[model samples]
Target: MITTTSLKNNRTFIILFFFLLSFIGNAQIGIGTVTPNASAVLDITSTTQGMLAPRMTTAQRTAIASPADGLIVYDTDLKALYYYSSGSTSWVVVSSGINPRLNFKRIRSTDNLATVLATELAAGGGAKYVLNSNTLYEINGTVTFNFPIDLNNAYVHGLDSNDDIILRTSGNIFEGATGGSIRSLTIRAATGSVFNLNGAATQNLIFRDCIVANSASVGTISGFGLVFLSIINFSGNTNGITYNNISQLLLSNMGWFNNNAGTYEKLTGTFTLVEKQGGFSQVDGTAIGFDVSTSGLTITGDAVLESVVFTGTNTAGYVKGYTTGSYTGYNFNNSWNVRAAGIPTETDANAVGDFSMDYTVGSGLAVSFTNNLNPSNTVKVGSGTPLTTYSNLFRFSTDAANRLRYQGKKKRIFQIGGSISFQVPGAGTYIIYIAKNGTVISQYKIYGRGQILNDIVVLPLNATTELVNNDYIEVFAQRYTGANGDIVVPNMTITIK
Candidate 1:
C-alpha cells in the first residue's frame, strides 16, 4: 500500500539510525587520526602539532568564572604553567621553581607574615618580601617556609623577653634558600635564640651587616650549612655561637662582641674550610674572654684580635706551623697555634712572661742604697726600737741611664750575691738577716773585732725561692754587745738581669 516516496523515506531513516548506533557504540572521537583509544572520549595525537592550552595573562585568567579544579592554563605573564586550585579558590603554579621577578605579597607587619607566607609556599612557587618597619614583631609560634624566598630589607626583631621571633623548629627558613641576604637588622632573644636555624641545612645563608644580641643562656646562632657573616655584631649569648655539620664558613668584618663563657664558641662538628677576615673588638678586662676548643681546626691567618685575651687552655686542638699574627692594643696570654703536644710554645721571645739576660761593656754604672750609714744620711744599727727594721741593699744599674728597674714590681730574674762591709766598735758577734719583702728568709752570723769586717755576704738564690712580682731583698744588722755598729756597703753588686 505504500508509495515509492514512502519507501525512499524509510530507507533514508534506516541508514541514519545505523550511523547513530555506530557513533554511540564506539564513543571515541579522534582528530588528525582515524583511530582513538577505546576509553578516551576525545583524543588528539600529532607529532608536528602540539596541544594548545588556554593562554592568558594573570588578570585574564583570574577573570574566569567558576573554574573547576584541574583546569589547566598557561600564564603568558609568568611564562609558567598553572592550574586552578579548588581548595584555595585560586590559580597556582604547576612547578616549584620560582622566578625571582614574580610579585610577592607584601608583609608590612609580623601579624600577616604567617598568612601570606603560607599562601605563597602552598602555591608551589617562590616569593619576595620587604619588611616596612624595624620594630619588634612577635611570632606566635614556629614558622616553616619551604620556598626559596628573598628577604629584601626584612627587619624582623623580637622582644628581649620573648623566646624567639622568626623561629624555625625543624626545617630551614626556606627550601633552596640561596643568594638571599639578611641585612641591617637588630634581633634580640628574650628566652630563646633569635635565629634557631637548628636542625636544618641552609645553603648560602648570609647575615650581612646584622646584629644579634641573644640573652638566652644557651646560644645565639646554631645551625649547619655554608654560612657567610659580613659585618655582624654578636653579643650577650651564653654560648656565642654553636654550629655543627658545616661545609664552609666565610666571615668578613664580624665582631663577637661582649660575651663570656668557658668556650666562646664550639665547632664540634665537621667542616672543609674556614676563612675569617677583617674583624676587631674591645673586650672587658674581667667580664670578657674566650677559650676556643675544636676537634680538628686549621687556621689560615693569625687569630689576633683586639681587646680579646686568649688563654693557654684555649686553642687546644688546633693545627700548628702557621705564621703568628699580631693583636693590637691587647696582649695574647696563650699560644696562638697549638702543637701536637699540649705544652704551650712561645711565638715571640720578648712576649709576656719571658726571662732574658743581656750583657754590655759600658761606663756610667751606679749603685743605690736605701739606708746608707754616712755622715749626711746616717742609719744606726742596734737593739733599739726605730733602727731594728731591715734595710734594702744597694741596687745595681744595668742600663746606661738605669731607666729600667728590674727589681720592685718590674718583671725580672734575680741572683742575690753581694757583700756588705761593716765596722764594729768593740769585739762582738754581728747578726745579718736576709729578708725578702719584709719577711726573714735566711741569716748569717759574723764574728768581728774592732776593725772593718767585709765578710757579710748574701747567699745565692735557689730554685725553692718564691719570688713574687715587685719583691725587693733586704738585710738587717744587729750587734749582740748592745752597742751601735757602722754598716758600710762597699763596692758590691747584686746581678738582676
Candidate 2:
C-alpha cells in the first residue's frame, strides 16, 4: 500500500536521529548557554540558580561505602561543609565554624600556627579565642608564629621535653589572658623578644616543665596567681623577669638563671604572698638573683624562701635585700643565704635557734659595760672582778646573770678593741684583759699604772681572738702590784669587728 518514496523518507529520518545521538555523546554539554567553558567537563552557566550537593546526617555520611577521598558533602548535623581527608582518615570541617568533634587542634611544624589561630578565633567570633579548659593543644615541632594570639584560658602542651616543640616568635607571642597553662614547650625568640604575661590582678597563669631560652625575655608579669615549676635553661636574655602587682607567686624546682645580662628584681607593687622552694639554683652569672633593691619593691604580706642556692662570682652579690619597702612577714628557712645590706636584728631566742651564717661587711658586735652598782670593794693582788651591767649589745646576747655571749654558728677571727675606765684604790700597776668563759686570756692583758688614789685611769685594750658559738666574753681587772683594794670600773666600751 506504500510507494518507494515514502520508504526513502522513513530511512532518512532514522539516519538523522542516529547521527544526532552520536554527536551528543562525543561533544561537550552545556545548560542555559550555547558554549561551555573549555576547562570544564559540564559547564552550567546560570544567574538565578545554584548547584546542589549531597546533604546527609552524620550517620548517613559515615555509612557511605568506600567514599572517594575528595568527596564533599553538606552535613545537616554540623551545618557546614566537610571533606573526606584520606591522609588523616577523617572528615575535616572546611568551614570556619565550631566543630564539636574536634577537641583540640594539633599543630605541626609545617602548619601555620597563626592561620590556625585565626581560624579558631573566627570560629569563636570574638576578639580572643576562649579555649576549652579540657582541651590540650599538642605542639609537635618547631612552629613559628609571626603575630601574637590572645588565647583566653588555653593549655598549649608539648609532646616532648627535649626542646622538640619550639615556639619561635618575632615579638610578644602570648597576649594577656587568665587561668591557663603552657607546659613542656621550648619558647625561643631573637634578642629583645618580650614575652609578656600582663593579665589582670585577679587572674592566674602557670608554666610548668618548660624552657624559655635563646635570648627571650620574660617581660613584665602582672598576674595575681602566677606559678613557674621546673623551668630550666632560662638564659641569654637581655633582662630578668620583672614583676608588677602580683599577689601570689610560687617558683619551685627552677634551675639555672645563669649567664643572664641583667638582674632579676623582686616582686613590686602589691605583692602579698611569695614562696620560692624546692631547690632554685642560679650559677655562673654576673647577674643578681632576687634583687630586692629595685625601686618600689614591696612585699605587703608574706614571703617564704627555702633551699635556694646561689653560686657565682657576681660582684653585686646574689639574693640581695636592701632598703626594701614594708614586708609584714618573712620566714626564711635554714638554707637561705642572703647577702643583704640591711637585715633586721633578730631577737636572742630567734638567733640562738635559727641563726645562719651571714656574709655581711663588718660583721660583729659592739657592747658597753656600765658600772650601775659602783660599790667599793677590795681586791687582793693577782685577783680580778668581772665587769657587769652590759648595754647596747649588737650581735651579742646576755645570759640571765648578765654576761655577753656570742651567738654565731661559725668560728671567725674577731679583732677586739675598747677602752676601760677604772679607779685604782692606790698607786699601783693594774692588769685588765679579756676573759672567755670566766678564764683570763693572757695575751689580751694590758698593764696600766695609777699614779694617785681615787683617780680615773683609762686603759686601751686590743687583741685578736677566734670565737665560736656560745662563747661568752667579759672584761676583768686584777691588782698586779698595788694596795690590795678595790678598782672600780665606771664604764667600758668594747667592739668586736
Candidate 3:
C-alpha cells in the first residue's frame, strides 16, 4: 500500500525527532545564573535566594528507598539536619552540641542506675550515657567508666564539710580514657579513693564546683590529670592519700581537712590557694602539703590565712612561691610544725606579704595618713597633732587599732618604699622615717627649694630581729620649721617576701 521511497522518508523523520528529544532532556539546567557546569545536571547560584534541602519527618526520611549517599534532609520532628549514609543504611546526624556518642537512645525506665548505664553505654555511639535523675548510683558489680560520659545530676549522701564521698570499693571505680565531667554533683565514696586510675591512666577530668569526700583514708588517688575548680569540700580520709600526676588544684574556698597527710607525686602544675577556709591540715603523721616524690612540682599563687593547724611529725615542705596578703583567719589547732627535710624548707612558711599605705595633710590641723588601706596590714598615723606651725615635727602616733600584729616568734624581712610629694611656702626639710615597735629603723630627708618636690625611697629594712607576737610597723613624716607643708601624698607600698 506504500512506495519504498515514502516509507524510508517517514522512518528517517521519526529517528531525527527522537534524537532531538534525547538531547533536550540531557541538557544542563541552571537557576539564578547564566553559566552552568557542563557535567552538572542541575546547577544553582544565588545570593538572595537559598536552595532548600528536602524537609521531612523521621518516618518520611526512613521511607525513602535507595536514596543517594550524599542526600541531605532536615528532620522536622527532631529539629536536626541529617544526611543519608548508604554504608550505615540510615540517616546520620550533622551535629549535636555534645559528643556524637552521647546522642544514643535514652533509656527512661526507672531501672537500677547501673543497669540503665550499662544499657545506654552498650548502645552505639561510644561509651556515653546520660543519667535521668539525681541518682545515688551505687556500684552493683565492677563499674568501669571507660569513655567520656556526663552525669547530668549525679549526687551522693553521708558527706562531711570536706565534700569527700565514701566509695564502696577501693578498686578503680572511675577507670577510663579521659574527658568526663561531674557537675553540680556530690560523689560519696563508700570504700576509699573515688578516682582510681590504677591500671590505665586518664587525663582531663573536671569536677566543676563539686563535692568529693571520703572516710577512713581516701586512699591513693592517681590519674593523668584533674581539675577541682572553686569550692571543693574535701575531707575524711584520716590516713592521708597520694595524688599523682595531677595538673592543678584551684583552691578558692577549698578545704582539705581530717586527712592525716597527703603525698603528692609528680604534680607538675599550679596549686593556687587564695583565701581558703581550711587547708591541707591533719591530726597526726608527717603532714606534707605535697611530698614532691618525683620532681616537676611547680607551685605558685598567694594565700592569706586567718589560722592554720598542723600537728605530729612533719616531713613535707609548705607550698613554695606564693604571695601572702592580710590574714586574720589562722586556726591551726594542731602544733604549727613544718617538715625537717624538703625543698625550700621552713618551720612556718607562708606566701609573700603585701601592704599598702596612703597619707595626706589634715585640713583640721592633724597631718596623718588615710584610713582606707588594703589587706588591713599597715597602720596609718592617727589624727595625733596637726601641723599648725612649721617646726612641729608632726608628732605622729600609729592608730594601734590597725597594725600588722606579729604572731610568729621570728622576724620577717620587709622591702619598704613610697613616693612623697610636698609643696613648701619657703625652703624647708621633710623627714620620712620607718619604725618598728617605737624604734626607728630607716629615715630619709628631702630638701625642698621652696617648691613642690617629689621623693621616692626604697630600703630593705630588717635582716633578723625578734618581734615576738604583737609588734607593729609605723611610718612618720616630719616637717621642719616655718615650712607650710601642703603635702599631696600618694603611692606608698610595702612588699614582704
Of the candidates shown, which would achieve the greatest lDDT relative to the real structure?
A: 2
Ranking the candidates on lDDT from highest down gives 2, 1, 3
**TM-score of each predicted structure versus truth:** 0.33, 0.49, 0.33
User: What lDDT does the true structure give each of the candidates?
Assistant: 0.43, 0.60, 0.42
Instruction: Give the residue spans of candidate 2 off by over 4 A.
Output: 1-102, 121-134, 192-194, 283-285, 324-497
- lDDT tens digits by residue: candidate 1, 64-135: 999999899998755678888898776778776343233432233344444655543444443433222232
Better of 1 and 2 by lDDT: 2
lDDT of 2 at 187: 73
Q: For candidate 3, lDDT tens digit of each residue in 1-497?
A: 89999999999999999977865977877787666677887889888888677899665887988999978898775567888778877678877623133233222223343555664455424444444334443322223343433344343222232332323443334433443444444544455445544312334444445555554444443443444445555555433345544444333444455453453112333333323233444333444453333344333433233333433344333332222321222212111223322222222334233344444532222343333232112223333432212111111112342133344434444444433333433444445555568664543323333333333323232323334435555555555434343443333443333
- Judged by lDDT relative to the true structure, which candidate is superior, 1 or 3? 1
Each candidate's number of clashing pairs is 2, 0, 34
Q: Report the C-alpha displacement of residue 56, candidate 2, in angstroms.
A: 18
Q: What is the lDDT of residue 285 in candidate 3?
A: 47
Looking at candidate 2, the ten consecutive residues that score lowest on lDDT are: 351-360
Per-residue lDDT, model 3, residue 416, is 40
